[model samples]
Target: MTSEETEEVVETTTDSSTGAARITAAPYMPGKTFTNMFEKYATDGLPDVFDISFFGNISGSTIAQIRSTMRYFDLIDDQYVPTDLMKELVGTDEETRKGLLKMMVEEKYPDALGLSQNATSGQLAKVFNERGLTGATVDKAISFYLHMLDYLSIPYSSHFKKRRPSSNGGARRRAAKKAAEPTPPPVHTPVKPKVSTEEEQKAAYVQTLLDLAKKDGADADLQDRIFDRIEKALGIGGGPAAPTTTGGGTTDSP
Candidate 1:
């Protein structure tokens, strides 16, 4: 059936207590043990009487508790025959079965189940004791019902398994080492000198003027004028060679 249909079934199915008092005399039965019993019953049908041998080599008292617990939940009839509810549960899907089980618990034992849903077994015991119910017996009953609920995938908090401590000591050491180490300084790249297009043009002009001045038969005065003009355009103060004497010596004051 669809989940919605299953939920409708659960919602419609009410308590079938038949004026019978809720079972509070049984010890807590593990969810797996109850599952085993249901599986066996589904195959072989309900037994004439509670039998420890049928379940494991468990105690006789444990067997009686299991039987009483089953009856209290209305899973079996007075004749020890599997009821219609048990029959329906036998082959239902997991989610549907859980829904049904939750509905059954809520309807049949509203007070105990409602209280257990929010409180621990010990805390629930105190509340039940105030109501004149045997605290220990009520505690065990709450535990058994809670286990069944858990097995059926109902949302209920229970004792959590302790987690083991991690053993990656080397990883922790490496992490500590990384944190303790200092950060390195950032790297800087050296800047290169740049020559502008204007400077390049001025250099070419100076070179060309010098070459012209060095040519054979070039006029000394003309070469001096060209050198002076080139030096001025290039932002330089020095002029070219001064006029030479007929003996090829520089004319300087003695």
Candidate 2:
């Protein structure tokens, strides 16, 4: 071969080898900051040429692969892929940065898509209990889902209903009825009758004895004799002057 032809062929071969060894970096994820770069790329818009081959020659298969990767990682899904730009915009950490990429790759190629990658309603309580997680964890997962939905700007009606508590229907009905019933009123005590004092009765008895002694006579001698007789009969006079009476015989003051 001629020297010129040999040189040209050698250069050509070198260029081809260099091209084969070339490795491109991945592009920023799509749908960041409400910018639809994936759509634009798929529709033949060249935003920038660097690492463009990683997102190469967009097609249905490529889109599906991207979506699958995002979903598997629990970061993005078919409806959304948060861009690295968005992460930068939010100023998150390196862990999150690496995590986002890793998630995207996993979603692209999931081994078990049927299992609970993201928490679902029916699977939430079961998975939570299995993992020894709390209801708060499940609530956080739901909140995450809602945040993603909002980020996607997906419209949902406020009137949307959720599943009722899972328990016996009859038991639930009975509980509802019991809760609705009115409570009974409290009972009150009745008043009692009034009673007389013992001191009053004693005073009346003493007064009756005094009145009887006064009616004995107006004369002092008669009064004294009547008082003495009454006192003797009642065994109230003291010492030797007191009278004694027994069933066997009559007795006088000693």
Candidate 3:
């Protein structure tokens, strides 16, 4: 069968559990809820077997939400065992963990991330509310997601951060004035010219050959031949360039 047909079949089968039709009605859980679950699993240790009862005091629906989120992130395998990603997350340094989490969110929750980018919690909450999500639930979810962003040191809308009230209200007025002011046109800096040294030029030539080989579907033997020709032409590997006699003067053919 053709690759496209094979892909379509695989997608159709996979979608039986996690397809668009199924996802549309999936429960929405905030980023904070996910982080909380991760922390719980870390502290208590992820059980070898999946057990709804392991989540003490948490509702069955909440457990289901957590499980769905985990599955969506590919953190758990078909047998519910923690995947390599989950193990890496648990063993990695804080910065590495944050990077992994950020990547996960970008990959799995890009829509929500895009909505939240440069938007205040209230603005994000409004978007969810418009989509028929409960106000309280939306607020909680947005708050949690924002918290996750902060933990990851990812920059977001500055308006989301809490500001102290100015005693004289001067700071607020100045901020408003600044916002009202027209932005200045950006200045373009002239690029400095780069001069490639002899070694750099040789390196660039070699790279060009490699790129051409890749583009032309060169086999190992063809690539080796190309490299051999280059070496011989460059007088490398004890090979000297052929000398040409032009106007009774000898010059290397290069």
Please report the candidate that would top lDDT against the real structure: 3
RMSD to true structure for each model, in Å: 18.9, 24.5, 26.2
Look at candidate 3 and tell me the lDDT of residue 101. Answer: 89
**lDDT tens readout by residue for model 2, 123-172:** 53443343333444334333433333344443333321142334536677
lDDT (10s digit) by residue, model 3, range 93-141: 6678788988976664444556644676566555545444463445544
Q: Give each model's whole-structure lDDT.
A: 0.57, 0.40, 0.58
Put the candidates in TM-score order, highest first: 3, 1, 2
In candidate 3, list every pair of residues with a backbone clash.
none
Give me the displacement of residue 149 in model 2, in angstroms: 4.7
- lDDT score, residue 97, model 2? 46
Better of 1 and 2 by lDDT: 1
**Clashes per prediction?**
0, 6, 0
- Can you tell me which runs of candidate 2 are displaced by over 4 Å? 1-120, 149-254
Off-target runs (Cα >4 Å) in candidate 3 are 1-33, 36-44, 77-79, 115-123, 126-132, 160-254
What is the alpha-carbon lDDT for the whole of candidate 3?
A: 0.58
